[model samples]
Target: MNNHIPILVEMQKLDDVIAEKLVLTESLPKRLSGLKKDVEDADNQVSETKTRLEENRKDQKLKELEIKSNNDQITKYKNQLLAAQSNKEYKALNSEVAHLESQNSLIDDVILQLMEDESSIKAQLEEELKIQANAKAELKANEDSLNLEIKEVEKEIKKFRDQRNNLAKDLPRALVKRYAALIKNRNRKAVVFNNGNKCGGCGYVLRPQVMIELQKGDEIINCENCGRMLVFHE
Candidate 1:
């Protein structure tokens, strides 16, 4: 029974490694998801900026057409002023030309403002596009690295599992069954060291007789309260 303690300790070491590997496996996908989201957000910013620039260009075109139409109206009004038969008609034609010129002046100011805004927006869009490209490249590299790491971790877990199985084969069948049952019912810790006179698994105080048996290491001694295999390491 005392000889079996070393095998159980070895099994516990393998179980600890398996548990850590499992946690790492679960975290890899979450890391990949986070990187994907970063790239998506950068792409969205670039798309929205391009849409705004296109709309601004359309508005500038419309303003230029309006200015051209106003100029044509002014030319026609000047021709009517020359053919006027009365002073009143002449004044009316001149006023119409003035009104059209005034409207065109305002339109010109608006066009200039639109041009400035377009220039600024174009620069911003170029910068955003560059950032988006970099983000995509970074995501791809990280994804490849993470995939490789996941494979390595899986291989290590397999190795540890094989080692534990081989060790279990050396122990008696009944003892293995008992150890398995304890692991299932006791938080995966089938064997524990005594902490002074207390059970290390459940912190239960051992009776004087149980403590004496554990110290001798002659037979398997379970904690009376928690039923976990107790080992006394000198």
Candidate 2:
């Protein structure tokens, strides 16, 4: 049974290797997910800003048309006043010209406001475009880097699995089966340290008898609370 201690230690080392590989595998998707969200948010902001800029330009066009129509009316009313025979008709034509001028002035003011708004929006959109361009480049670079990293991690995981299979070949069927099952059910963390009297995996107080057995290091023992394989600490 004492000779079995070496085998138990080797098994724990294998478990550590597997756990580390699993951690590396889990990180890839999370990193990609977060970066993807950032890129998407930046793109949406750029699109919204561009839309506002375009709408301001359209409003400016409408104001221009309104001003032009008011100018035409003012010119027609002036001609009518010049040709008028009666005092009343002349006064009416003059009032019409004044009204058209007032309307044209208001439209001019509106056009100015629209032009200012358009200028501000264009500037904002330009900034946003620059930000989006930089973000797009960063996202592309990050994705490329992550793809390479993922490939390397997959290769390493494959290598570790191959090694694990080779190691399992020399172990007893019962022990291998137990280890595999625990790894599958326990977040890939099949092995845990025994911290003096406590099980590091579950914080459970190790039974005195179990602690003695662990000291013997003869056989694999599980933490009853968490069902994780325990390795005695140095």
- Best candidate, TM-score: 2
Q: After superposition, which runs of candidate 1 have C-alpha atoms over 4 Å from their true positions?
A: 2-4, 169-191, 194-213, 216-230
What does candidate 2's lDDT look like per residue over 33-141, in tens digits?
A: 7778777888899899888888888888888888888888888888887899999999988888888888888888988888888888888888888877887777788
Give the TM-score of each candidate.
Answer: 0.76, 0.86
Reference-based TM-score, model 1? 0.76
**Backbone N/Cα/C clashes per model:** 0, 0
Worst 10 residues of 2 by lDDT: 1-10
Off by over 4 Å in 2: 2-8
RMSD of 2: 2.4
